[model samples]
Target: MTSTTVRPDLDLTHARWQSGTQGMGDVEIAFIEGYIAMRNGGTPEVPAVIFTPGEWNAFVLGARDGRFDLT
Candidate 1:
């Protein structure tokens, strides 16, 4: 079975990052080594925030549920 666990030494040097559909210079995300890596397109030199699949799912659900809505 495919593992969803990210390796401690995960390498993202060759990650093919994809930007949001809105346009360029937005947040970029890369799925690599069983982890999700996110970084700002405007500042790629900065370290990315890594998330596990479960964490990503939770964040997505929260967004869809408007848990982060300002209202």
Candidate 2:
């Protein structure tokens, strides 16, 4: 996992974030620089995961293709 600084001036509380599964209302995704930052709901101060551009692209493609779907 990679770590990056989220802009303090930005407010992510109301930002929209989606995870692989439902029922997680507090999850949010933010693209910062060359990485994708995922923050848990109500915890904007911390990031759950920071994916690199390549990793982010792979995840996007996988999700699009339903590769992450539970079998």
Candidate 3:
């Protein structure tokens, strides 16, 4: 949920994807044109979800604040 507009014209063909140190099942992320692209590491064939800088920050903040905790 961001107030900024997303850049759909950005190309991710050469994007170098990164993942956490948790080994096999971790998700992948790529930084491209000031936006964050996320995708499943286990299934790279699936298209990625793009997020604006503000949306990425908000997601990180929410994760750090335990808003995503299921317990």
Candidate 4:
């Protein structure tokens, strides 16, 4: 299983709640060398999903190929 982490600090009160947009509309996507992070745009001071870079890339590719279709 891919190791993941959720940021312990972030706020999501004003983020534009979006769905089917990576599972959360209020979230934003970002990444570093070995970690991918999804955080609430409105509340950047609350928790968010963090995944290994590899896993994040895989998900991206899958989404590109219709593998992550929400419908």
Which candidate tops TM-score? 3
Worst 10 residues of 4 by lDDT: 10-19
Q: Write the per-residue lDDT of candidate 4 for residues 1-71, one digit (tens) a residue.
A: 89555544434344343334455556576644345567776877777676676678888799799986889
Better of 3 and 4 by lDDT: 3
RMSD of 3: 2.8
Model 4 lDDT, full chain set: 0.62
Ranked by TM-score, top first: 3, 1, 2, 4
Q: Candidate 4: where are CA atoms >4 Å away?
A: 1-26, 42-46
Checking candidate 2 for backbone clashes, the offending pairs are 26-41
Model 1 Cα lDDT, one tens digit per residue, 1-71: 88675446667789999988879556899999888888998889888888888888998899899999897
Best by lDDT: 3
Pick the winner on TM-score between candidates 2 and 4. Answer: 2
- Order by lDDT, highest first: 3, 1, 2, 4
lDDT of 2 at 10: 46
How do the predictions measure up, each by TM-score? 0.76, 0.50, 0.79, 0.49
Pairing residues by index, what is the TM-score of model 2?
Answer: 0.50
